[model samples]
Target: MKNKFIKISVCTLALSLLLGSCTDDILDEQSRTVYTPDYFKTEAGVIGGLTGMYAHLRYMYGQAYYYNATLTGTDEATWGQSADGNFKDADLSGVGNLNSSSSRSDVLWNTAFSNINAANGIIENASAVGISEALVSEARFFRAFDYFLLVQTFGGVPLDLGSGELKFNVSQNRTSVRNTVPEVYTKVIFPDLVTAVANLPDAGRVTGGATKTVARLHLAKAYLTYGWWLENPNNIPTYPETPRTDPDGHNAQWYFQKAYDIAIEGIDNPGPFALQPTFYDVNVATNDRNNEILLMADHTESSEIFNGGSLTFGSGGAPDNFAGWMLTWNYTSLVSGTTPAWTAKVSSVQREAAQPYGRPWVRMAPPQGVFNNTFADKVNDSRYDGTFTTVYRGNWDKTTLIGTNPVLYGANGIAVEPGDAIFSFLNEEPSQPIDFSNTTYNSGIGAGVLPGRADFVLPPSRISRRVYPGLWKLGPYRTDNAGGLGQPNAGSTRPFNVAKFSELYLVAAEAAVKGAATQPGKSARDLVNVLRARAGKWRYSNADNAVFIQDNSAAAVAATPAVIDINYILAERSREYFGEGYRWFDLVRTQKWNELAGTYTICGPNLTDVTPQTFTRTIQPFHYLRPIPQGQLDAMDMPDADIEAYQNPGYE
Candidate 1:
C-alpha cells in the first residue's frame, strides 16, 4: 500500500526523474540524488529504485515510434499515407529499410538497460537494507522483464552492463560484449522470473505492481518462446552464432510442456485478474485499468506533471501515450455541407478529446486482410467491432461550425445532425450499390455513398494506407473535456496495457498445438473456445452507437474447428490483441512472421485510389533478429572488427 516515487542516481546509468503519484500506480515523481551502492543500501533508496523500474516502462510503451516498431511491417499494419521513414522503414516492402539506426526498436534498447541497471542495484542492496523479499521480487521481475525484451529484440544483449554478470556496476565503462541467446535466457530471464513467481505476493503491493500471476505469465511466455527457438521450425538463424541448444539440457518439447502447465496454473490462480465480461468492457475508455489487464504502463489525466507529458498537447515523443494517433486517419477532413448540392462545406466530425476522435497522425494503418480474413465473422464475434472505430459520427456541435443551422447535408443529400454517423468504414460491403464517384458530395476522403444512409461508407476492400478504421482500443479518453473539444492533441492518459489475462489462454493453446501434452478438458480447442465464447457475448455495439445486448456464445463456440492448429491460434491472437502491439512478437515467437505477413494488400494513399495493391516483404533468415542498435555500437570503445562482430548478422 506504500506507493512513493523516488529518484536515485547510478554512476553509469542516467535514470530519469520520476513523476506524479496515484493510488495503486507506482510511476509518481519525486527526486533525490544518491550514489548507487550506498544509496540502494538504504530503505528509501531501495523503494525509489524499485519505482524507477515502473517509470522506465513509460519510455517505451506509450511512445508512438516504439509502438509503431512492434506492429507495423507485420500483417496487422503497414505504413500509412503520412508515414515517414520510421514507419516505412519497418514495412520492409522496399520503400525504406529497417536497420540499426532507423529501427524504432531503439526505444526499447535505450530505455531498458538503464532500468536493468537500476533493477540490478535494487536486487543487490534490498536485502541488506532490510527490504522484504516481496519487495526484492519486484526488482527481480523487472530484471527478467528487460532481459526478456532485449533477448527477443536484439538476440543477445550484454547481461553484464559494465561489471560482472548481473552485478551493479558502480563505474562507467563503454566496452560491451554480446552474450549468446541461450546464455541470456539461462543466466538472466528464466532464473529471475522463476524466483519472482515464487516470492511475489498474489496481490500487487501497489496498483500496477508486479505480482505472482504476472511473473507466471512472463515465465511461461519465456519458456514458450525458448521452446520455439530450440525447435527452429523454420530453420531461422540466430545471432551471436550460437547453437539453438538449451544450456539446461532440455529439448523444445520439455519447454513447451512447461509453458502449457505454467500458463494454465496462472489462469487457474488469477488473483486479481480475470477476463472482462465482454471485449467492449475491456477497452471502453471509461473502463480503463480494468481487471482483465494484468500489467500496463500507467498514465494519468489529472496533472501534466504526473502524466510525464503535457496534458494539453503532445509532440509525439517518449513518455507520451501518442501511439493511438498514428493509426488514426484524418477524420476531421470529412466535410459536410449546407446545401443539397454540397458546395458550402463544414467539418462534421471535428477532432475531439474522446475515445473515437483523437488527433490523427496517419502513420500506420491496418491492411485489408485484417478486415476480410482475421475478423471475417463480424457478426458472431464482437472483437472486430470492439477493436476499431468503424464509424465517424458528427460532433460539429462541439465546434463553432455548428453556427445557426444544427443540420448539415451528408451522403445522398440527406439532412444530418450532431450525433448522426458522418462517415463509416462498413464491416462488409453493403447490399445496396455504393457510388464511389466524387461528382456528388465531396466526402473529401474518397468515401462512397449508399442510397438511403446519410453516412459515407467504405467497404472492407476499400481500406487504404491513407484511411482505414482507427484503432478504437487505443484511442484517447478524457473526463475533463466538458462541452467542447478537449486536448485531443495530448497523449492518452489511459494506461497502455502490456499484458492481459486473456493472453494466458492463447499462450497455453499455442503451446499445446506445438505438441505439448494437454490436460483433461483443456485441449487446444477448449482453451480457444473460452475466449471465442466471450467474443460472442456483446453488451455494446460500437458500430450502432448503442447498448445492444446479444449472446451468440453457442454459435461462436460451435464455429471453432474440432482440431485447432498453430495458424488458428495465431488468427485468434490477432483478433484479441490487434494494434495493441503484440503482433510482431507473436509472429516472431512462432516463426510465422514471413509465412503470415510476407504478402499483404492495401490501397494507395490517395482517397480515390481504392484499388488494392499487393506488396511483398523481403524477410530474410537474418531479419529474424533486429539489428543491434547503431547508437549502442558507437558508444562502445571496441575495435571496428569487434563492433562489426557485435552487430546482428544482417545490418553489417
Candidate 2:
C-alpha cells in the first residue's frame, strides 16, 4: 500500500484484506510474527498472500530492468552505465564499486525464496478454504513464476516443494535444496504450469492482472530454456569432433519447439494484452507500461523508466554521476534516424554528469560498432523509423503527459554553442556522415588522437563524433540536456516502454524456424518472415527469404551455415530488440563479448596496459553468468565461486 507513484484505487475496494503490516523497520525475519495457518482462513488472507508476493518484486523487477540492458560482463558496447558499465571494466581497487549491490540476481534469489514462502502458506490453506480454483491457480502460477526466475539465473535452486506444513522450529529453519534440473522441471515447473494452462482462465480472465495464459508463458520459457537441464552432460552429452550427425544428448531444439507452441497458443488466445499493432503504437517515453508480453511489474508509478528514457534497457539514469561519462551518442544517432526522428540538444560538455546507479536500464549510448552494424538503418527498415533516432534527448511537455514538472532549462541545461550541429534521426538512407566534436575512436592505420595530441579534430568537418546508422531506442525520457519533459534532470515524459515484446518476437521467430512451426503445423520458416516483414526487413518473398527458407538442423550443423546457427538468432534478436536490454545476455549466450575500456583508443600507438582482447575477455566473463553478488556469497554457507574476483562463479 506504499503507493508513492499512483495507487490502485479499485484495489482498496476489492479487498478487506488488511491482515497487518510487519512492525519491523524493513523486511527482516524477526518482524514476521503474524503468520499462522489460521491467519489465511478468509478471502482477506488471499489478498494478503498476493500482496506479500508483490512486496518482494521491486528488487528483482528493478534489477531485471537494468541487468537485461547492459548484459555485457564487459563489452565495448557497454555505454558504461549502471552496474553494466562497472562490470564491463571490472575494478575492485577503485574506491566505490557499482556492480555488487545493484545486481538483481542477489535480490532475485532472496526475494524469490521469500515469495516462495508466502506462496507455501497460501497453497496449504487456499485449497481447504476453497477460494475459487482460479485463485489457487494464481498462487501456484506465481510460485512457479518465482522459481522460473531462480531457475534461469541460479540454475536448480533449493526447491521448497513442501509448504507451511512445517511450523515450530521450522520458522527458524532455512530451506533445503532439492531436485536436480530435470527433477524440478518434471515436478514443480512442468506440472504446475500444465495445471495453470488448463484450469486457469484465458489471458484476460483477470484483467489488470496476470491470468492463466501469462502463467503459460513462463512454462513455455522454462520448457524452451530447459533451465539447468542444459548443464547436465548426460542430457547434452559431450559429442565427438562432429556430433550433429552422431547425435547424443537432450535436443535443445525440442525445448525451443515447446516454447514456440506455448507462445503461439497464447497469441491465439488473445489474453489481457495484444502486441502493439505498429511501431508507432508503442510509447517509448513511458519505458514500459501495458505491454502485451509484460507478465508483471508496474510502470504507471515512479521510477520505472529509471534508465535512459527509452534508449537503454530496463534501468536508464536514476542514480547521479560525475562528468566525462559516455552516454547515448550512438543512441542519439539511432533514435534520431528513426521515422518520426527525435532530435536532441547539442552541447560540447554535459551540464550534468550521468552516474551509474539506480536500476539496470540506463540510456547510455550503444557501442560504436552497434551504431555502424546491427541497429543502423538499412533501406528504410520500418523499425528504423520507430526504433532508431539521432537525437539522444529532447524537450517536451511533461505536465500534460505525466503530470510531472519539466526537467530542462535553456538558460540552465544544454547551452548550445556555435557550430554545434544537433542531429535528428530519420529512417532514410543517410545522405552524408554527420559528426560530433567529442567523438573518440581507436585508429586502424595509426595512432590518431592521443594525450600528446590534444587537438584531435583538425576542422569542424572532422568532428570527434561520427554518425553510425543505428539509434538508441531504449531511453525515450533521459538525456544530459534533460530538455524533454521540462525538468532539468527529468528522465522521460512517456509512461510505458516495451523492451520485451520486440525481442521476444525475434526469440519466438528463431525457435519457430528450427523445424518448429512456421504456421502451427507448417514450416517454421514463415514465422521468421512474419516477424521480418513486420520489421520491414524481409529480404525474401514468403518462402524464398533466408528466414522463410527451410532450416535443416543437420544441414545447418554440416556447413555451420548462417541460416541455422546461434548467430542468426542472436543477430536477428539484436536487430529486433536493440535497446531493449537483452544485448548483454544475447552476447553471453553466443559467447561474443568484449569490455569497452580499450577497444577504442586513438589509432597509432598501442597501449601495453590495455588490449582489445582484454575487453573481449571481460565480456566473456558475463557469459559465465554475471559476477555472483558478493553479499550473497558472504550470506550463504554454500561453497561459492571466487567471490572477491568479481566473477559470476555461476549458478548451482
Candidate 3:
C-alpha cells in the first residue's frame, strides 16, 4: 500500500530516484535530485526504489509487441490484414521474419534486461542501505517474473543478479551469457518467488505490486511451466541437466504437484481472490480493479501522457493501447448500407457512442471456425457472448427511410431506431444468401428496401475484413477519434487485466487431471464444471437469456457436463481469455503449439468455392520458442561465432 515515487530511466540498468512520499502532493511534481545510499535505508526510499523496478513491467505487458508474440501463431486468432508483414511472416507463414532483428523482439529483450537490472539494483543495495528484507523479497519477485518471461520467450537470457554485473556486463561488454531455460527457472525464478512468498504480506496486492498470494500464484505457474518443460525437454535443448526422455525422473507430475500445492495455498489463503459471479464483471470498465483481477497492466485514462505510444515512454508514460487495437473493429470503415457495397464508410455518433466498439484497426481477428470449433456449447456458454459483440448499430439518420419502409423491423415490428441492431449473425457464413423477403428480419435492409440499394441483399463481406464481431473484453470504447492516429493513439484508455482468479481454477483442474493434486470427492471434471456452471448460469440469466435465443437450449445445456479433458480446458481458456494475451505461451507451455496451430482455419464452413479460405495458417516445431532477437546477438561483445552459438536452435 506504499505509494512511493521514483524517476526511472527506462533504457538504463540503474533505477535512480529521489525518494518521495506516498501522497500525491509529494509525487505530483518530478525531480532529478539523486539520493545517496543512506537515503535508501529509510522505508520510503526502499519503497521508492521498488516503484522504479515495477515501472519497467509496462514495457512488457502493456503493448502490442507482447500480444503479437503471444496471440498470433495460435489457434484463437489470425492477422486480419495482409499488409502487416510481421504478422503474416511470423504468424501465418511461420517463416523467418521473427528473427533477432525484429524491432518487437529487440524491445522485449531490452526491456526484460532493463527491468532485471533495476531489480538487481534494489536487491543488492537493499542490504547495504539497511532496507527492510520485504523490499528484497519484492525485488526478487520482479527479478523472477522478468526472468520467467525471458526464458519462456527466448530460451535462456543473460542472467544478472546484481547492478555491478549488469552494469559492467550488459552496459559495457555485453558479456552476460544466455542461461539455459531450466537453469534460469531453478536458479533465479523459483528461489526469488519462494523468498517473495516468505517476505510479502498475505493480501492487498496492487497492479504493479506483488503480495504473498500473488507470489504463490506465480510460483505455482512457474512450477506448471517448468513441469511442462521437463515433460518435453526437447523444447529446452539448452537445459543443463539430463533430459527426461523416459518421462520418469522428476517428470511433469513432480512439478505439477508443486504447482497444485501452491495454487491450493492461494485458494485456501484468506484473500480477496475468487471468481466473479457473472462473466461480464471481469471485463466491464465500471468493474475496473475488481477482486477478480490478480494483476493488470494499469493505465491512466485521464492523463494524456498515458496516451498510447508504441513502446516509447517519452510520449508520456507506458500506457498501452492493447485494447484499442486488439479485439476491436474499425467502425469508421464499415461498408455503407445504402451503397449495398463493401466499401469503407465513416462512423457516426450513434456508432461512436457504443461503449465496447472502437474504430477499426483490424489488426487481429478469429475465424468463424474458432467459434464453431472451440465452443462446443457456443450458445449456452456466456463467455462467447460476453466476450464478443455480434451487433453494430447504424449511425446514419434513417428516420425518413424507416418511415417509408414498412418491412424494416426493429426488435419486434417497431421502426428502426438510431442504436437498434444494424448488424447481427456475424458468425454466419460469408457466402450464405440473405432472404430479403423476410419482412420481420432487419438484415440491414430487407423487404421495402430503401432506394439506391439492390433488391437482393448480401451481408457485407468486408465485415470479415473490418468488423467481425468486435471483441468486447478490450475497451475504453471511444466516442471520439475513430481512426485518427491508428495503433498506439487510443483516444481513451482502459485498464488491461493480465491475470484473473478464474485461471487458478483452470490451473487446479489441469493439475488434478495430470494426477498432481488431490480433489478428494471432486474430479478435474468437477473443477471445470464449476466454471461451466457459472458460464451456463450466465447464459440463462435474464439479461443474457435472449442472447441464446438461437441456440437449442437442451442441447447447449447437455454439452456442459458430458466431458472434460485437456482439450476442453484449453478450449475453455480460449473462450475465457480471448485477446487478453497469453494464447501462444499457453500452447507452447502445454506442448500443443504445433498440433493446434499447424491446422488452423479462419473461414471454416463460411468459405465458399470462390473464397479460397484466406486465413489458413500453420506452425512448425521451431516455433515452440521464439528466435533469439538478432539485434541482441549482434550487440553481444563476444565473437560473432560465439553469438551465433548462443542463438536458439533452428533460428540460425
Candidate 4:
C-alpha cells in the first residue's frame, strides 16, 4: 500500500531468497517484509518493487571497496599507503592475492543477483497488475543491466536464480548452474534491452531513471563487449568453457557493426541529453545530474533516511557514495608554519565539504604514467586540470590551530592567506630546481619548496603512493554547510555517474576500430575527435582556482593520428573518463590488460620515498574474469566437484 519512496529494505525479500545460506552473513537481517507473487500483482507493490530496482545501484556504484576492484590494478591506479588487503589484493602485484574471498567484485556479486530476482518479480507480475508496458520496461532494463555486468565480470553467471530462466522464484533454491557466455547474452541481456528500448519512453520516467537512450547505450556496449568475447583476440580462457560463437550464428563483425549502428542511433536521438559545451562543465560538482549524464546511482542530501546512508558520516560501506575518498590522499596531513621563520606547524588544508577536499581513505593512488603518458599534453587538454585536484589551498582559518595568526608561512617562507594555494602538484617538472632537501619549508608529505611560489609543489615524477593529486572529478560537494566544514566525513551526495552521453562516441569509435563499417563522416577518427575537441575547451582552471578561457580545439583535433587504433581509443577514453572506474573493463574488453598495465611506475608508500620504482602484475589469462565470490560458492547446495567447476579457473 506504500509508494515507491519506501526504502529497499521494506520493498523486497529477494536478497535472502536469492543468496539462500549466505543471507545471514551478507544482509544485516532477513527482511521481514516479503512480497508474494500476488503482492506484485497490485499497483502499490509493482511501483514499490520498481523503486527497489533503482535503489539497488547504491549497493555497488559508490561503495569504495568495489571502486578499488574496478580501477586499482589497471594503468589508472595502484594501492595507496593506507591500502588494506582489499586494495592491495586487487593490484595483483604480490602484495596480496585476489581470491574469491578477497575480490571486491563481490560487491557486484552480492548485490546484483538479488536485484535481478526482484526485477524478475516485477517484470512477471507488473503486467498482470495492468502496469503500463513502459513502466515494466524499467524492470526489463535493470534485469539486462545486471546480466551484462555479471557476464563481463564472472564469465558466465547463473541466469536461473532459483527460478526458470528469467522467471520469478518464490522459494529458496541453493543449487545453481552456470550459463554459457553466448547463452547469457543471447537469452537475457540482449533481448531485454531490445524490448526496453522499444517500449521505454524517450525521457526518463523519473530523475536518473532508465530510458530509451540509456537502454540503447547499454545494448550497444553489450554488443561491443560480446563481440570482443567472441573474437578473444588474446586467446583468454572463459568459464563454462563454451566456444566463442554467437548463438544466433552471427560473426564478431556482425555484432561490431550492430554496436556501431545502435550507438550512432542513440547519439542522433538526443532526448533531453547532449554533450556539455566543455568537458569541465560535465563533471564540476555544481553541474552534477546535468543533461549529459544519462543515468546515475541517485543520492540525496535532503533526508538521511531516504538517502540510504548517514548525511554527516559514512561507514564506507554499501549504499554510501564514498568512492571519492579512496583516491583522495590525506590532504589534512599537509602542514604549514604559523610564523614567517617557520617555527610552529599547523594543518593548512583541513577536510572540507567543498569539491576539492573530502574525508581521505587513501586506498588507491594513480601511477606516474597517468601524468607522463596518458595526459602528456597538459597544455591544451582541459581534462588533466578538470580531472585532478592539483592545488591544495589554505583553509587553516576555519580551524582553531591557526588561532590569532591571519597568515601561515608556506613554501620559501612566504605568507599565505585562508584561500591562497598552500601546496600544488606540478603538471611538469619546474625549470627552477625544487628544494626537496629543505626540510624546514618542505611539506612533510613529499612536497618540495619552489623559489618564489608560496605553495609547496610536487612534480609528476615525485608523486608517491602517500601523496598524489586527488580525484577532483568525484570529490564531495555540499551546500548545507554555511561557514564551517559541513560533514566532511559524510559520503558524497553527488550522483555517481554510471553512463554519460559522451561515452556514446567512445563506444561507437571502439566498434569502428574493431573493423565495423563506418558511415560517411562517422569514422573512428571523427567520433574520437568529437570528445578530443571538447577536451580542448576550458572555462575554468581547477589548478589555478580562477576563470580561464581557452579553446584549442584545432590543436586537439590536429593531434589525432590519421589512422587511430584500439590503443589510441583506450588512451582517449582514459583522458576523457579518468578515475571514474572505466579502466579495468576497457583493458579487459580489448584484452590489453597485461600489455598496457603489466608494469607501472610509482614512488613507495612513505612520504620521503620519492624515487620511482616499477612494479609488475601477474596478469595471467584467468585474471581477465574476476573470481566468483566465496559467499556465493558457500551458499550453493551442490557437490564439491560441481562447486569447483562453477568457480572461475584460477580462483578455485
lDDT (Cα atoms) of all candidates against the true structure: 0.86, 0.40, 0.57, 0.87
Candidate 3 segments exceeding 4 Å error: 1-9, 14-45, 94-96, 161-171, 205-208, 233-249, 305-318, 335-354, 395-415, 426-467, 477-492, 539-563, 603-618
Candidate maximizing lDDT: 4
Cα error, residue 291 of model 4, in Å, equals: 0.4
Candidate 3 Cα RMSD after full superposition onto the native fold (Å): 6.6
C-alpha RMSD in Å of predicted model 4 compared with the true structure: 2.8
| Ranked candidates (lDDT, high to low) | 4, 1, 3, 2
Please provide, for model 3 over 40-78, each residue's C-alpha lDDT reduced to its tens digit, 9 standing for 90 to 100: 555665566565555555556646656666776677776
Residues 1-652 of candidate 4 have per-residue lDDT tens digits of 2111224532343534344322111122224355568867888777767777777888888988898889989999999999999999999999999999999999888888877877888888887879999999999999999989888898998877766888777657778888999999999899999999999988886766788999999999999999999999999999899888888999999999999999999999978889999988999989988889888887778876667778999877877899999999999988888787788888888999889988898989999999999999988889999999999998877766564568888988899988899989898888888888876785768688877888988899988899999999999999898777789999888889998988889999999999999899999999999999999999999988999999999999999999999999999999988988889999999999999999999999997688999999999999999998888788777899999998999887
| Steric clashes per prediction | 6, 106, 7, 0
> Stretches of candidate 1 above 4 Å error?
2-35
Better of 3 and 4 by lDDT: 4
What TM-score would you give candidate 4 relative to the actual structure? 0.96
For residues 322-357, write the lDDT of model 1, one tens digit per residue. 889999999989989888788788888888889888
Per-residue CA lDDT of model 2 for 42-81, tens digit only, reads: 6666656665544344334434334433443332244332
Question: Alpha carbon lDDT of residue 159, candidate 4?
Answer: 77
What lDDT is obtained when candidate 2 is compared to the true structure? 0.40
> How do the predictions measure up, each by TM-score?
0.96, 0.62, 0.80, 0.96
Error of 4 at 98 (Å): 0.7
Model 4 poorest 10 in a row by lDDT: 21-30
Collision pairs in model 3: 100-629, 100-630, 101-630, 329-360, 330-359, 330-360, 331-360
